[model samples]
Every structure is written in structure tokens, then in C-alpha cells.
Target: MGAACIRERLDRALCSHPWIDRFPDTLVKHFTDQGSDHRGLLLSDKAYTRNSRPLFRFDARWADNPEVRAMVNYVWKEEIQGTPMFRLWERLKRLRHLLYDWSRAGTTNSLRNIKTLQAEIERIKLVHPVDWDEVRNLEFELNRQWEAEEIYKQLKSRVRWLKKGDQNSSYFHTVTRARRKRNFVAGLRSDNGDWVTEELGKADIATNFYQCLFTSETHVPNMAERVDNLPISQSITP
Candidate 1:
């Protein structure tokens, strides 16, 4: 149970049902101000299913590393036995696999990696004069991870206003969740008075409505002559 007290006495509390655990539910729900001492619980059971969407993308930042470019050059120099297009596609596919593995190499538990790097830096500073080369490497790794995270957030949120390295991870997370909630269609009432609670049903109902509206048989009445008769701001000679 959690609560925010509006009264001076702190007498109010918010709680979940005793049987809430029996069902898969949490008490971390919002409430409305009903002008009462106690906050009324908002029991929300809205389930928003997000489909797995892994996009095939090449990180342009990988081009910044000379080692990566060298690898690409080597791959291109290799003569693969295939049609020109097929050979190119195969080589690119192989490069994509290599880059994906490289990208994932240090990205797992990035926070832990950041902390570890920070600790190492601190330890080095205390033990000896800071190794600037090691520090730079650590900073580079952190920046790369941050860029990777930003790319993920940008794709997931669909909001392009925010730029990378603005310390807006929290903002991106909030925006992404809000977008998911906004996109969720809990239910829709169909023309036949049937409630479409299923995902496919809701989609069909919305699709048909828009399709019908666009393909409407209603003719638009001509109002060009009526507009011409209306009083004009400029003096008309005719």
C-alpha cells in the first residue's frame, strides 16, 4: 500500500484488495481526488500488448572507428562466388552480423560497465597519476553505450525532438510508455452494437470506419457561387 496525504492529519491511505495477489495485479495505481479524507483506488486492468519489433539498422557511428572500416574494406576486397547483387548482399549481410556482434559485445549490463569503469578510474587516480589513455577509452565506451541507448529510445518512442547526450533518458522512458498507453485501444463499439474488446476486432472496426469515411458516396455540394455573393473586404467594381 502507498499513499499521498492531502489532509494535515495524514489519516488517508491507498490500498489494494486483499485478493489482488490472487490475481496478477499491483497496488501501484493512481487515484482521483473525491474531496474525501481517503483516496479512492483506481483499479485499472488495461492490458497493452506491444509486439516485438526489432528493426534491421546499421549504426552509422561504427563508421567512425577505423578498425570497423578496415574490416568492411577487407570484406569488400574478398571475391565471393555469386551474382554481383547476390555477392554484395551476402558480403553486407556478413558485415551486419559482425557489427551486431561487436555492438552487443560491451552493451550487455552497460550500467554495470559504466560503474566498473568509473571505479577503475577512481582506483587508478588514487594509486597513481591518472592514465589519460585509459580514461579516454572508458569515456569512449560510455559515450558509445549512451548513443546505443539513445538510438533504442528514439526508435521506441517515435519522438524526434530530443537529441542525444542531453541526459533525457528518464524523459524518453516516460514518453515511450505514454505513447504505448496512448496507442492502446482498450475497446471499441462497432456499428452493429457489438463491443470489440479483442485487438484484431478493434483494429478492424477502426480500419472500416476510416475506409468508409474516405470512400463515402455523399456528394459535396457546390458553394462557389454562394462564396462569390458574400460581402468582400475590398470594394468590388462588378
Candidate 2:
């Protein structure tokens, strides 16, 4: 039987049947159809066997823990060192590697290690208690560093894609446009009353910018219209 059907049957049998005490963790055995033209039976300890297959495991409870959030925050704080802004950029690289390993192993060893360190700090607090505030501050700083690192990595990935001429897709174009708009706005602001010479020249730049914007708007719609108007047979094959 198919895997889902097998699981459903097994679930019913397990709940109702008294003979079947426990299900084996491993597969029973592979069976072939014989000349009798009948499906092979799956032999288990309990009842008559039928064709069976392995079921995929799903564990949802592990993802919903508050401790997971606390652990992540703690690990992030432990990684931060100097100026939060600059340190975030550097720490992001390290965080990315740790995250990859966490995914592959399906565990958070790095976060767990940080928790152990935090526990040690707590123990020291019991003895002296003077540096407790300092310890807490350091932890907060580390978490901020990790947060900044994550933001930097996400922005870096988007920037890399933009640099690679990957704006053909609608989603890519949308992201590129937003990034460009944000950077342009940020560059235009000045601390003093006087504007930068480059900023003053934006009037000249606006003409070319608007021209390109209009061209893109016109072309994208025309391309979409053309695609929509094409014969279905020409776009698809039997």
C-alpha cells in the first residue's frame, strides 16, 4: 500500500488491536507480487500483514519553544565585540556558518554552548554580584551584534544579486528598485544647511533618471501585453 494508507491502517490497528503492543522502528521487509497475482502481506508481531511503506516523521513541537528564542538571543549577544554597527557586519559572516551547521545537524550546539557560558556567569553572580550588571550589558550587546550581523547578511545577498545583473524577474526588479530608492534618499540628506555639490547636481541627474524610468515602465507593460496576446499553442506543446 501507499505510505499514507499504510500509516492510517497502522494508526487504527495500534489504537484498536490488543495484539499489537508496539510498532517496530524499522521497516518490516520488502515483498514482491507472486504468480498468484496477490499483493504481499507485511508480517508484524500483531495481525495479518499487508504491503507497508515508511512514513515521514514530523516534529512541530520543537519549533515552538520560548527557550529557542532566548537561546538565539543569547548566542547573538555573545558574538558581538566592538562598535555594534561595524561589529555587526563582521559577526554576520560567523553567524552564517553557525546557522548552516545548525540546519545540517538539526540542533543548536552553538546556542547551547552560549547558554552554558551564561550559566557560568550566573554562578559567578552568586559569589560577587558586583559585575552582574556588566555581565547583563555584555549579553545585550552580543545579541544586538548578532541581530545586526543577520541584517547585514540579508542586505549583502540582495546587493550581490543586484550586482550580478539578475533583475529580469519581477521580484528581483522590485527588490532592486527598493534598494536603489533607499540608497538614493540616504545619500541626499546633509547635516549642514549647505547641500553637497553632488547633491545640488541632482536636478541634472533627475532628467536621465526619469527617462530611464519611463522607458522601463513602457517596455514592461508592452512585453506583458505581447506575451498575453500570443497564441496558446505557440507557447505550449502537447
- Which candidate number has the best lDDT? 1
Per-residue alpha-carbon lDDT of model 1 for 97-160, expressed as tens digits?
7777766676444456667777876776776666888878877877776776666667666677
> Candidate 2, clashing residue pairs?
42-49, 42-50, 76-142, 77-142, 77-143
- What are the lDDT scores of the predictions, listed in order? 0.63, 0.44
- What are the per-residue Cα lDDT tens digits for candidate 2 across 151-227? 33335336443332222344444454444333432123233444433533444355455545443434336777788
Clashing pairs in 1: none
CA displacement after TM-score superposition, residue 139 of candidate 1 (Å): 5.2
**lDDT of model 1, residue 32:** 55
**Runs with alpha carbons beyond 4 Å of true place in candidate 1:** 1-56, 107-113, 128-159, 174-238
Model 2, residue 123: distance off in Å is: 1.3
Which runs in model 2 stand beyond 4 Å of their true positions? 1-24, 44-111, 137-238
